[model samples]
Target: MLNTNNVDCCARVRHGPSVAGLQQALGNGAMSNSISDIENSKCLLVLATTAPTPIPSSPAG
Candidate 1:
C-alpha cells in the first residue's frame, strides 16, 4: 500500500503475465500453471516477489 519502498509494482506483480508460454516455446511445458494446478500439487516451486494477496485466509473458528 505504501509507495515509500523503492519496489513499485505491487499491483502489477499480482496481475503480471503468468509467463507460461515464453518458456514453453523452448521446452516441454504446460501452457499455464493455473490456480488449480498450484492447489493440487504437493511440490511446487513458487517464484514470487510477494506472496499472493486477496485469497482471504481461513476464518478463525
Candidate 2:
C-alpha cells in the first residue's frame, strides 16, 4: 500500500542559504582545505546544540 513513486527520501537534507549564496558569489562551492588542515589551525570555532559533558567516574572507586 506504499506510494513511493513521488517520494523524496532525502527531502529533509539541506544546506544553509549562506553556504549556497557564498558559493554563488564566489566561483567555488567546495572547501578550500581538508580535515587535515585543522591540525595547523591557530584557533578553532566549535558550534553545538548543547554544552559538552564529562563522563562519570567508575562507581567502584
Candidate 3:
C-alpha cells in the first residue's frame, strides 16, 4: 500500500546528453588540434548552439 498525500512529487526533470555521451562525441569537448591548424585550413565549418555575438574592439592606445 502507498500513501499519495504523504508523497511530495515536487521535482524538476531535465533531458540532455549524459557526460559519457559528450566525452564520446567530442573527446572532453576540447580542441584536439592547435590554432595553427585552423589557419592552414582552406575552408572552415563553424557549429554552435547559439548565434554568435560580436565584441567591440578596444581603442588602440
Candidate 4:
C-alpha cells in the first residue's frame, strides 16, 4: 500500500537542517563507508587464496 502524498516530508525537512548543513559542509558526503557494487545481484562469490593455518608462528630471535 503506497500513498502518493507529501507525507512526513515536512517533519523530515524540519529536522534535517543541521544534518543537511553538516553534509553540505563536508563536501556533499564523506563516502568513507563501503557500499555494494552490484545492484540486484543474484549471487555473490568470495574467493580466498590463503587459508589460515592451525599452527602458530614462533617469535624471531
Candidate 5:
C-alpha cells in the first residue's frame, strides 16, 4: 500500500547513543559536577579543532 499525496512519505531516523552524547555535551552545568566547577573557576582556557566547509550553491543551468 502507498499514499502518493503524503509529502512525508520518507522515514526519518535518530540514533539513540548519538542523541544522548549530544545531550550530554550541550547539557546545562547542573548535569555534571565538573561542568559546575569549570563554571565557577576564575580562569578558563578553551582549545578546539574545527574543520570548516565552503559555502554551497546550485550550479548555473
Candidate 6:
C-alpha cells in the first residue's frame, strides 16, 4: 500500500524533510505513471542501495 502519504513520510525521514526525494521517487521509472498503471502492472522490480536482508534474518527460518 505505498502511496504519497507513505512516500512523503519515508522521504522526510530518510532524506530530511526534502521533497526532492519524493519527487525523484515519483518520477522514477520504477514508479507507476498513474493508479491505473499500477493496477495494470503485473511485474514489479525493486533495486535498493541497501541490502534486502537484516542481521538475524534467514532464507528459510
Which candidate number maximizes lDDT?
2
| Candidate 2 lDDT tens digits, 1-61 | 1865555432134334646766887766656677878888899897863346643332224
C-alpha TM-score for every candidate:
0.29, 0.37, 0.35, 0.22, 0.25, 0.32
The list of candidate 1 runs beyond 4 A from truth reads 1-9, 13-31, 47-61
RMSD of each: 12.2, 13.0, 17.8, 18.4, 11.5, 10.2
Query: If both were scored by lDDT, which would come out higher, candidate 2 or candidate 3?
Result: 2
lDDT of each candidate versus the true structure: 0.51, 0.57, 0.53, 0.49, 0.49, 0.50
lDDT of 6 by residue, 1-61 (tens): 3654532233324454335655676754233367887679898676664656443322233
Alpha carbon deviation, residue 60, candidate 3 (Å): 31
Ranking by TM-score: 2, 3, 6, 1, 5, 4
Clashing pairs in 2: none
Clashes in model 3: which pairs? none
Give lDDT tens digits, candidate 3, residues 8-47. Answer: 3212121124445667887773456789999999998877
> lDDT tens digits, residues 1-61, model 4?
1776533333244336756765888755344334564445667675853347332233334
Across residues 1-61, which tens digit of lDDT does each residue of candidate 5 receive?
A: 2866544311123234655665788763223447779879999675552327332233224
lDDT of 1 by residue, 1-61 (tens): 3766555443344333444444557453334557897889989775764455553233335
Better of 4 and 6 by TM-score: 6
Candidate 5 stretches with Cα past 4 Å from truth are 4-14, 28-61
In angstroms, the error of model 6 at 61 is 31
What C-alpha lDDT, on a 0 to 100 scale, does residue 3 get in candidate 6? 54
Clashes of each: 0, 0, 0, 0, 0, 0
**Between the candidate structures 3 and 6, which one is better when assessed by TM-score?**
3
